[model samples]
Target: MSDKILIIDDEPGIRSSLRGILEDEGFNVQAVASGEEGLALIKRENFDVILLDIWLEGLDGLEVLKKLKEEEEKAQVIMITGHGSVETAVRAIKQGAYDFLEKPLSLEKVVVTVKNALHQKKLEEENLILRSKFRNKYQKLVGESPVIKELKKKIAKAAASKASVVIYGESGTGKELVARLIHQQSSRKNKKFIHINLAAIPEHLLPRELFGYIKGAFPEAASDKKGKVLLANGGTLFLDEIGEINPLLQIKLLHLLEKGIIEPEGSLEPIPVDVRIIATSQVNLAPLVRAKRFRDDLFFKINVLPIVIPPLRERKEDIPLLIDYYLDYFSLELGKKKKTMTSAAKKAFLNYSWPGNISELINVIERFVIMVPEDEIRPEHLSLLVEPRELQLTPQNNHILSLKEAILHFEKEYIHRRLMTNGWEVKRTAQELKVTPQELKEKIRSLGIRIAD
Candidate 1:
């Protein structure tokens, strides 16, 4: 958008002329006669630049400027002074005025000042964006658990020093998050953190993806293009799923780690880079090395400071807190009212083993919010979960029970146990129990198991 400019002056001619000049220069200009009106405008709208006459009918220019700054209105203000007010102008300049121009204002000087102020504003905005990115990139790594605390400590330690790091974690355990946190807190925070998922890219194109390919280097080469290693120069390059990378590519990565230089695909010139290599893997490194699937030399090179993240099931205590965090997040994001998991539901959640860990829990919570009726989430609100028949039906005097009652009790126990085992996955439970879903539903209904809610 064109920069917004507010022209505030008691002189009618000055206001009109300044507005015309600013509008012609592609600014959104608004003219006000008094500093009072200008202050009101500042309160209600966002402006890029403000030109305030030192003398005004209501609030004085300096008073308005002070008020604007106090209100934290982020805009550049240039004070306009009358002749023989050099002292006043000097004081205004000291009080955060971008520039002081004498009245019978020069149009050229006005335009030039506006341009410079807007350019400075642009730089401020760019700096804000960079800071925001840094904050956002590490936001997912939220928690003060001992594990997380130690992980942050390790990240800070490794980031402060120039060392190769090997992040070890199960899939969906957020290994990438640890990698980003390290880079953001490091000395090289100003530079790039280029990430390449080794397993995601094709085997044949891995070399070209890591190292830039020159024009006519290969069959599809129409132009020279830079690769991640080159783009991530002076910063860090994170190789994700390092266990899946081919042995030859491992050698190439090892070469870069060892020599701090890489020869791009189909290029003879070796480009020197000061990139900190951070590699991650979900697999056990020792088994892979023993099997000869991974090069032992490369493993030793990248595994300088290893960080292991246990699976989600092992960290059940953090699940409830994670649920609250995600609930708040999704509520804001989806524009829904805030909700919480009921105690019964929380009990069911803790009882179930999360094979996919935090990732799986997040998915279940998302589904629960979208599907569960009413404002509160109950145990049955989790459609993703199933229950054993014993938990479903209560029976006394086992021998004295009728055949129909016995069948009902047995069905309830079976269904509830399967549900607990499968995290209440009804369809999977049905399939596992060798029963049609419709039959299972009927049985659950017949035993009043479906009436829990």
Candidate 2:
């Protein structure tokens, strides 16, 4: 669609000239005789840009501009005048005119100014969309399981205090989601929420990445940089996979926790930071701390407000609700009609152990919504389950092992296949095998099975 331009001028010649020039440039131009007509059009329709003359019949251009400002209008307005002066331009700008143009307006200048204004409007619109998405992602925690309800109650309490939080959960168990929820619900909701994954950063580059450096701080420190702590000042900093951080950095981090201050590389001055810390770990930190891999004192400092999220298997009742939620979400996202699962299909999903958790379920839902042409998802549609069950063993191979060995081998293979199908969600896989999650973990360890990425 072409850009919409509104021309409000008293002179017939000026209106005609602008209309011709703008239309030729592929704009949808509408020329009005006075400010009243322009205001009426603005109320009824949307325009990308408006050209208003300073002198109009009933209401002057400045008055119209003031009214637009009061109404919180979004279009970019350029003031047009035959008697242009520094004072008039300044007044027009203060009244919310994007730019001012005198009579004998240059066609080139008009086009350039309009383009710049449009660009600025586009950026603002994009920012609004990003913020909306950010809000929607952390606005609420999904599911109605008892554990989920308990977590919500704890989150409210945690948000009320300024103490550092340490969230413990397995992979794909919504640890980061909980962190974001805390930030969204806390008083720092309007401020930045910076996240850094300790596991993702290389050991050699960890210091530079966490505590940014000044120019020539190191061989590769080309210019000055602001670290996550400084960037998250007056906000929250999420340190994901905190156990993966090396011991040296842990000491420095402990100091930062004691006194909300940071000294950038090659700088001696301490820069105070008012940042809230939210850390997450997938493994038990106590074991690592016992092994001297993680600092004990540092652990105590961050463990002030601890939150532990149970794996999905422990809350099996929420599976159906999660499935329905993902189905609706994916259907809308993929622009397809919402699909329903057959009772048998739902049962198959319910029985299967989900090794991957909610993230894995979402991927499966997206695949079914997009790939399956039928509106109903049946048991046959679940290839992850049906296909794996088809694996067979020959009598010649079966005779090689004792009954006990054959059972162990079968159990190991069955559990491994289910884990792969569910993206390695141990709790879900355990439920499928009719074994405790701890039993499945031990079996996986005993059988020497390595999960594929």
Query: Tens-digit lDDT track for model 2 on 214-242?
Result: 76888877756777776676779999999
Which lDDT value does model 2 have at 451? Answer: 32
- Clash counts for the predictions, in order: 18, 6
Model 2 residue runs over 4 Å out of place are 1-140, 384-453
TM-scores for all candidates: the values are 0.58, 0.61
TM-score of 1: 0.58
Which residue ranges in model 1 land beyond 4 Å of their true spot? 1-138, 384-453
Model 1: per-residue lDDT, tens digit, 114-172?
89988887687669747665445225665667887777788789888788888888877
lDDT value, candidate 1, whole model: 0.76
Measured with C-alpha atoms, the lDDT of residue 256 in candidate 2 is: 93
